[model samples]
Target chain A: MPTSFPPPTGDAEAEDTLSTLGEFGLIARLNAGRAQPAGTLLGPGDDAAVVAAPDERVVACTDVLVEGVHFRLDWSAPDQVGRKAAAANLADIAAMGAVPTALLVGLACSRDTPVETLTALVDGLWAEAGVVGVGVVGGDVAASPTLVLSVTALGTLEGRAPVTRAGARPGDVLAICGRVGWSAAGLAVLARGFRSPVAVVGAHRVPDPPYAAGPQAAKAGATSMIDISDGLIADLGHVARASGVLLDVRSRAFDVPARLVDVGAALGVDPLQWVLTGGEDHALAATFSGPLPEGWTEIGTVRAGDPAVLVDGRPYEGPPAGWDHFTR
Target chain B: MPTSFPPPTGDAEAEDTLSTLGEFGLIARLNAGRAQPAGTLLGPGDDAAVVAAPDERVVACTDVLVEGVHFRLDWSAPDQVGRKAAAANLADIAAMGAVPTALLVGLACSRDTPVETLTALVDGLWAEAGVVGVGVVGGDVAASPTLVLSVTALGTLEGRAPVTRAGARPGDVLAICGRVGWSAAGLAVLARGFRSPVAVVGAHRVPDPPYAAGPQAAKAGATSMIDISDGLIADLGHVARASGVLLDVRSRAFDVPARLVDVGAALGVDPLQWVLTGGEDHALAATFSGPLPEGWTEIGTVRAGDPAVLVDGRPYEGPPAGWDHFTR
Candidate 1:
């Protein structure tokens, strides 16, 4: 039924922590009283799960979130971490112009973590995948020194050719279909200790990716597509290098939402830096040789030059770098 | 070509370590000179990988290995750990009577890990998956306080219904195909510091699951099957409980390979205990209404009784207990 679980139920928290529940016990609890979608031919508790594939081909991707690096428990709830993990992986499937069908999640955490916290995280995982009409078919739980959430998303292209990053060419127009700096603005509000304007703060914890825009752009003949995960300019740099062409984008063309502007004023920071240099919103950024897709804002044009991302006739040097797991 | 990689080639280990290469640089090294199989519609270096789902349905499973809990880096090399990780996942697919196709790996390690060690792990991952004629389509790497490897395996049923644990009937016969206590014996030798016989130690480091036997059992009309991961008795108890019947077996029926018996004698450990209580050998145990499949050794009989596992008509108790990740 795609139900959601908040913080932790009193009954759940009253139970012994994960160590007392045991691995198998916790897994059984996860499947208890839950119904899977029809696409899940086989659910958890088996050696492997069988998920129906609507196409002869499946798109697969994996992402990992590490404790202290990706999220801090004080900054976000367990559910928010679970949601962001699922959202990031699902966005990759969407970036490939496919609909996500199922997710296989693996979690490793300290034995002291409460069972209620784990259940809340799992609830968040299902709730996020449910938003895209997919299911969590299988997963593994293990003991670790820190909490780690790893997600693998499987999707189908529905007979459409996969839109690769190399398909963009000169004269194609670059467009975006979702917000630019919401999560970054949200992060700033959280990092700078601002309590008001809960929207950005909440978004920093769980990103609302444009799930439908991926397939919609694919249907409308997107030459190349990518999710703005590592900032707009930084992610566009990947397409530019892969397509072997320069991408010239207008700074003003990016829709800087009012929330971001308001947050910037509160923190005395430049909102444009968040718009151009921030990431993790999972917005759809694609290049099209024809008319822009519905609801997409034309942001730039592909040019016949060196492989790079240029903003307003020059290379962007706002943040000095985008997010890198190791470097960060 | 499914070729094996020899330990750290000069070209691979000569590159800068992960600290200097960064995350993207490390990924670029992983994809530097590797060519994917034909079934991989699109390989790594993109948002997600596209794999051929020939049956229009995919069987998925996941397993996680945490250092200090699953393996000790001091006892097992990085390559062995990687091979064991891949082999265990591949075994789950085989247990479902399916052919594994693609694997997505997610790794989290401390920042100080050497690039050479990481590449060796990856090489071993490919070498093991290559044994089953599949490729690693995608993976994620992150900095973690402790090393954790999580693998998700995708397989195809090939028009056969999955051989689940619930299909065992009262009149069915039970059989096993592969070594039963090799890994447990290997662990004993390693813990006791035995040096002469290296076979058990090697087995402990990297399991050799009989991948072909699973499909063969399914083809020969075997009723059900499961991989011997959580000890023979513990795993059989699951099948017995699930099928609502008793599984009675003769202790002598189990083939205690000579190496295990010899190792037990030297350590004063009961060899039968290892055979009945050991796990992680990745051997296949199945039930059949007809004659046993080729190469299968008849070991037990399915009976109409309370759900339990009995050895020689009595309840069997051996090792202190099977592995419980949380408890451990």
Candidate 2:
């Protein structure tokens, strides 16, 4: 079983590098003693993992997190990095309005990387997957010059049509479930050496995606949905482009919570901009023609217009540029 | 769509780095003109892809290829590297006795990586997937200091039970359906810079695993099976340990083909060692309790004993400690 969070800053077991354990030993150690998921027909140690697809169709996606660009070893714990990697991919599966069932984590790191770090990463993966009531089905490990996590998630739709981004129509209300820009705020906090706001730092380390909101929104007749991983405006632009509709955000609609407001003020940055352009919250943003879902809050409106995102009746020209891995 | 291979060593388009085009633009360009596979219910451009799972069961596996460790950019063309990466994972699906259906690729590379290199890699991926009658389904891209490709392949069992390594029993005939050590020999030739035998070099670049032989062996009621990814003895040892049987190879049984012998002679390397201990052949090795499958050639026999592998009635100790990333 994955060990519980033992102080992220602790480095008691960093002396054991992977070269000592070798490839098979390291893989066995990572998955040893862990309980397999119920839906796994065949688990690790096989040629491939056989996962039970309850439905006839499967939903799948992949995401890669690089070492320095995606997360710095100095800034985030190995456990947090593992959790964030799994969370990012899990959120994508959720945005498809499907229930996640399996994960295949691929790790590439320097051979000198401490085995304890890898173990902690797997522990974090197990913890996050445990929240979804599943487990890591398969994985790959390799030696590289840097650390990289490429995670692929598998889910089932339970006999429902997927809520794709191109489904949004005119006159649909755009609402969001879960907090936005908290992660970006957390990044700022970590940068400025302000450790008081524990929530912000935690958000930056491990995003708390509203896991239940995806299926809930789908059941509530949402026409289109997306998770805010690349900021509200940037993700909304994807919907706008894909659906060929304009999304107009009403600034008054979002009541900036005190957590964000307080953090932004301390750093001399606008928290609303984080809400608008900050990504990585993994919050669900959806367009609905009917009444909004219980967890969703109205944030914008959709109309038949040139494919674009409008903030308060004008194009958004904010300071927070969207997060694109290459550009960043 | 993935562009056609212009030339193996062409550098005309290598000047356009990934940073210039950015993430979204690069992704859009990579996938813009591509055609989706028939089984892809929802292709790329979505948060997640929906693929038809015809059997209500999915066989999944992943493999990560890191630059320098897995391949050298200077040694291989971008296309060959991509194909090799995809082939490694696809071979796993074949080893499961399943049909390859979908792929999710995650790529991380330096910002200075040429756009053409990325395109050629995708081209290689597509070319190999086409060999299996499918195409890329979903993927993620990131920026890092080195190039990495993490590929996850999904396959369907078509209602057949998985042929695991733990099924071989006493008195089973051990046979293999694909050529072994060709890749290892090819690697030797490449290392020595002997370019005359193009076939040997190509095998090292992209392995041609016997994809059909897997399901064939399963259908033929092979009690145990494995792909020779980490060398014959190493992989056989896995089967021996799992199945609790001793596998003894008859020296005279294997007819080392002329091509392998010719190549070995040219490089002054023992081809038999490559055949015995070389890795990355991806050949299907199986133990059949019934009549041997038509294409499979008898090489060894399985006996109920302490789990071990022997050559010509004796324990075999040879060079080429199988490819383990951290150790290598």
Candidate 3:
């Protein structure tokens, strides 16, 4: 356990601190007495840490969540930011059909930021990491205008071959392992100034990717895989382009979650559009050679044609535009 | 080769251009036709990249270099920033006595940023990764106020037990594998609004850690190890505290790097102070149980005493503090 410093209460009082503590002193305070996992041979005190990978193959991915661009403090708490950062990275590892083993986080925030906020952030990170059975091995914290989190996840294949986007064959069947469009719908609810249930807002804050379903799909012979981070059509297009096969989705086959439908109905929007084009759902999208695996629902099929993703045998006419950091 | 939209020639640019390009299109552009080194079984354009960790044990570390806090765009080029980011993360992996194998980067920048700048940044990243025979296997790109680079490095241990910071014992000989204080000197020069030789400024731009020396020290029986990212005294203090030993340094051992001496002379500062308290040199400092390893110079000793670093039997005070992201 790390030594805890009491956080400032209420946002009313302005504090003139941080410079008094200094960076090294604060780092010492933050890194104090945290326990490292058994597989970690070296931890925070060193320049780098060594961990046992066991399977000789490591699955690696990176994601950056920026302030205002990815999330707003007014909408989410510090703990939520930390949880979201870890969740996004871990989802990428799961998408590769690997078990997440460790994580590294890079944080940049303004000076005068409360150390309590940081501790809360770390608590959120640890909370999510605990759920996934991974550890936060190392990180760097610095000052910036707004909070920025760069998370990298490392995973072990456990002797299984990695499922990549390019392995889908022309005749493979398409399946999804988790909920789709909930985050997007949640975002819509937030944007419209509607107070949603804690569960709905929680989905928007820290997405719950179906972590167990990834390795299960790999074991069930998934040919190609990807995380639905950039909407179903957009992410599947990566599979199509990489595998050199067109993917034709039968929209009726998709099993949209009831929560998403409820939110969409209450918010007065097409839930199907969110299912097709809304991103950050982080569900696993994969192609299988045989019958759909447990907890997976068949949604489409890989077709022999030029690489593309089509809805009901036609190009998606409604925006197809997913999240773009720079232009949007 | 990524599809290049005609490079921005004028100042005014259309908004929503990023949204128009879409997330998948941007990722496709970013990942198109990039070559990766061997051992990267699956590279970008996948859910997660797969790298061969061969040794079953891997070294990993991450750091975020934020604009203004970690770097200044007015002072350093985008390529320089890219190289520095890679060097810092790779040095962390190397400091663990592991050979770096791959890197994952996460970048967040504004939409108005030029694509040429992004390409040059990547060019510099590749240039530096080539030095240690490692290549970038994966990354993420998003939008933010200023540029934020988060890099994670992976390395192989090659059957050697990692040299951690907690293993330094009394009577262990302390040695260094690379130059120290050059970066600090360069930073001082930069801060002073003065220019020196290309080498001085170059040190500030791209740090050169002695990559080969890490594994060599491990082979020679290093007991504890860390990278000189912080000033020598400050970083050694970490070893002292972790290992419960006192570290005493003799400054005469730093005669090999004439640049350190020249920069100190030019700046009218004590060269010894820079050697002791300057940082970001990426040098490896390790404690050895036997004679110093090949390519390592004996600079200090671990002794049974209070956990502190002393120079010539006294605590050395200096003008410059070690590099810190916040509260500095």
What is candidate 2's DockQ?
0.81
True-structure lDDT of candidate 2: 0.87
* Best-performing candidate as measured by lDDT: 2
lDDT of 2 by residue, B65-164 (tens): 9998888777789999988888888888888888888888999988888788899999989988988888899899899888999999999888899988
TM-score, chain B, predicted structure 2: 0.93
How does residue A215 of candidate 1 score in lDDT?
93
Q: Candidate 1: give its CA RMSD in angstroms.
A: 4.9
Ranking by lDDT: 2, 1, 3
Measured by DockQ, the strongest candidate is 2
The TM-score of predicted model 1 comes to 0.95
- lDDT at B58, model 3: 78
Candidate 2 segments whose C-alpha is farther than 4 A from its true place: A1-14, B1-14
After aligning candidate 3 to the native by TM-score, how far in Å is the CA of A89 from where it should be?
1.4
Question: What local lDDT score does residue B38 receive in model 3, on the 0 to 100 scale?
Answer: 92
Against the true two-chain complex, what DockQ does each candidate achieve?
0.75, 0.81, 0.69
Question: lDDT, candidate 2, residue A315?
Answer: 87
